[model samples]
Target: MNVPTVPMLFVEIEGVLRKTPDDLGRPWKGPFDIEVFPDAVERLRLWKGAGGRAIGFSQQGGVALGETDEQTAVRTLWTVRERVANLLDHVVHCPHHPEAAMPDHARCWCRLPKPGMLIAAQHEVSLRQQERYPLWMALLVARSPEALQAASDLGLDHLHGDAWRRDGGQ
Candidate 1:
């Protein structure tokens, strides 16, 4: 058996690259206002400058709950992607939730901790680049135990987001 050696970085968006709306007092809205952490961006800048690729793995469940919609969710992601140049190569967001108000947004295998998002991204990368999985690192926020568990389930190497940043994202 052979393993794929594409060396892609699978990263968590909220709480990792960008500071999320944990203190917003409401579900986040579209046209995302949060700034990507400076050090995080610096790390990614260096990472990409060295010819590495990164993909943001996120779940925009606000669409499911009626706080936002799918288009807005997608736009927000692309908006962020435009902000940071040459860091993230792609973005994958899941708008599903088991308790979604909209029927279509409810229940999916793509939410974090489920591996759907990662698997889909895997296929996407392999298809587009003709190369595949490497030892992906799920750079997760320290507060998210669920993401850590999900990374383990996906059989990828993992690291704490803050620590990774502090370590200069090596």
Candidate 2:
């Protein structure tokens, strides 16, 4: 991967790459079943084919809420990655919720509303490859206002989930 020249795409798994929402607007209760949006795989393919590195990120507070365990939550991430043809370069999720029942998950930096996960991804890429990626060369693809806020905080370019999928994450 041309880590320096190509841009980075930070994708939100729920409501963007996958169809986990039901009619009530709540995500699937648990991570047992996984489903990818119809065009997500092709869109990701095009994004990667264009030399853009992709990272999957999400807010899996279910772990903190006692709805699921850390292992199960991570397993869902893997399932989504495989369903998308294994195109993602990295995947991260914030299992913490501010009012989480689990004390360990009550506070965290990598949560969606926070830019920690985004920063971690960029920082890791920079360190591992000894290459830097300017904020302009990165894009956060998601629909949530919280996610957009996080992108803005990091000065990373961003696009709505619909627009990105339509434009192949351009």
Best-fitting candidate, scored by lDDT: 2
lDDT of each: 0.71, 0.82
Could you say which candidate leads in TM-score? 2
RMSD of each: 3.4, 2.9
What range of 10 consecutive residues in model 1 has the weakest lDDT sum? 134-143
Residue 81 C-alpha lDDT in model 1: 74
lDDT of 1 by residue, 63-145 (tens): 88987788888887777777666477778899888787666689788887888887787678677766655554333333367
For candidate 2, what is the TM-score? 0.86
Candidate 2, clashing residue pairs?
none
Q: Write the per-residue lDDT of candidate 2 for residues 6-123, one digit (tens) a residue.
A: 6788999987888856623665755556778868788889888987788899898878888789999899998888889999888888889889866778988888778898889767
TM-score, one value per model: 0.82, 0.86
Task: Predict model 1's lDDT versus the native.
Answer: 0.71
Model 1 TM-score is 0.82
